[model samples]
Target chain A: MTGLRLAAVLLAVFAASFALAQGDPRRSGYREMGPALQKMQDDDAANPAMLFVQAGAAAWAEKAAAGKSCADCHGDATASMKGVAARYPAFSAEAGKPIDLEGRINLCRTTHQQAEALAPESDGLLALSAYVALQSRGQPIAPPDDARLSNLRAEGAELYKRRQGQLNLSCANCHDDHAGRKLAGATIPQGHPTGYPIYRLEWQALGSLKRRLRNCVIGMRAEPWSYDAADYLALESFLMQRAKGMAMDAPGVRP
Target chain B: MSRALAALLLLLPGAAVAQQDSMPSLTGKPGDPARGRAIVANRTVGLCLLCHGAPIPEERFQGNLAPSLAGAGSRATPDQLRLRVADAARLNPDTIMPPYYRVDGLTRVARSFQGKTILTAEQIEDVVAYLASLKD
Candidate 1:
């Protein structure tokens, strides 16, 4: 090839490789968080999310309306709950639909413990979710592969790409297209769920993945879904699947 | 068409239809650059600085997701800028930038915000005028 053609070919190859590199699906939100936030996530004692973890452990042991504690049925959390969070938003045969970890917890509560469903984002729910997710910290995210989950997962993928809100923005617009780019002085990370039940410094409290989703919808000037909405569960399934094989970083810290 | 004919055409219902069917043409009293600058920098109003960097120095934490508006006047005409701020999706089907004025085709809008534009026509004009002033 002539010199100009050869240079053009080299540029094309470089551009293709650059695009491929930028499309790394396994990129975690942890790296986008600055050093201070990283330190907060790394140290259990320093992590404010750990406070919720402790609270969750207490809730697990405390007797509820039926005089039955979670420990009574499930025994020690570390043993029984290991890797559970990584597999959630999984298809529930009982519900005959996909259910997230929070939903499953509420299911167990109302059915077996005879307790009322905890309100979404309530301290009790956050604590329990953080505690359970903390147990799966080192486990790889492995959302179930059941056929029942496929429909919801597809719906979720659509939601992730569908533009809503007056902003005419979709989750993919920022989290996918603009990941690693700065937005409002913060880096936009891929919308991964690995670090959910995270303690956000902005929130000054622990929040669930659904809460984060709701905030995004609101930020886009779109109406937000109610807590535990089917759409949220579908999105949760898609996010977890997107972060599959990445280690769980629950009870995580975020800015 | 003549200006009078076009103005008369706009008076008929649905005669204003264009490439972006839902977006209304922005035409009104001239915009004030000073007021425009304030709107763009305001966090709750224009919110331009949140995802766009501008020449404003006092606004800390200006974003870099979108192009800097430092010399936007030299880059594009005021009319072009008006359309972009009004309904950017018409220009690029996939833009993270929010439509500052269009109200239709949105989902899940809060009850109070239903049928509301993020900026008024005058505010959009003001922003466009202010942007037009930012020469390199």
Candidate 2:
């Protein structure tokens, strides 16, 4: 009974903050909203995810381990790559495991490119995978309609809702409960993936959507996924889909 | 924390130069680039040299985050630079640069210095003046 009351009080405080954020004048949004919205309706390249596409083009064209190219195996990405990035974080029957974009890309690198997989968080891996994610920018994120993904989504939601860290926060705590409220003197933006693989000034580099998610988890003081694995991407898929229509902010700048 | 950090950061310029007080007050004084250079070198209060590669007079412990401010007087207007310095994250929310002025709600620093300056408004203006003094 005591615990329930505490939960109720906390929920009310969080709700108060949420109520305050509605149409608050202090909430500064991205500067490129007008042009950004226009482009989202037009060229696929204009999609912020296109930064990854550009990066993908470069990675695909660069000479590889076999003195061949990803383009050599799959030419003119427009047709061959269309909708490929959409159904990612999919399950792989061969490995008897689920896989994300990076996983699928690395799988091809080993089988087709005859190359070693890039270690997670390494520049080549992130850049290459980010490039690939761009191809499916406008497509609805439909993780291969499978039982595996359903299970992963449930697990991910549990992880998001669990409280962690000295701050006693969860991913949902600030994002879902008190999103847009002032915290530690800064307004908390709605935690969304509309803009990602963004250039974070704090990090001084372009980072993947997963990297941002991991940073949030770390901020929550929970043990983050040590590897850029399939499980995490499934969670990323769930989160990003929830934030659909929010806009892809690839190559974006964030606090 | 703010008071101690401010004093410590200010002491840096004195440590870099052979003579103390040779570098005049950071504020007031028509904003000298030469003095700004020294402050940057000292990695003290102005610590501008720490993150940028200007006419670096001494050390290189500066961060690689921000671009060099050399010839910034001619490149970007003083107002633009002023806004960037006031709160770089406001301009580029992701910037690692600290706002030398404008302490609306900083909570980490000492209680005695709660509303105190992070490089006074005058000092920030002077830093702008000093930066603007450097041309071509």
Evaluate all candidate structures by whole-model CA lDDT and list the values in order: 0.87, 0.60
DockQ for each model: 0.55, 0.02
Model 1 lDDT per residue over A1-255, tens place: 699999999999999988966875657878778898898899989999998899899999999999999999999999999999999988778877778999999999999999999999999998999999999998999988788899889999999999887676889988988888877788888878998899888889889999999999988878888885789988998888888888898888988
lDDT of 2 by residue, A71-122 (tens): 8978877667765665666777865777766778788788778889877666
Q: Candidate 1, A128: how far from true, in Å?
A: 1.2
**Candidate 1 lDDT for residue A47:** 98
CA displacement after TM-score superposition, residue A220 of candidate 2 (Å): 1.9
Model 1 chain A lDDT-worst window of ten: A20-29
TM-score of chain B of 2: 0.63
Model 2 has a DockQ score of 0.02
Predicted model with the maximum lDDT:
1
Error of 2 at B117 (Å): 31
CA RMSD (A), model 1: 8.1
Q: Tens digit of lDDT per residue, candidate 2, span B1-136?
A: 9999999889887675423212233444465556555655555466565446666645544444356777888885666666666665455543446556655533233343345555666666667777777677
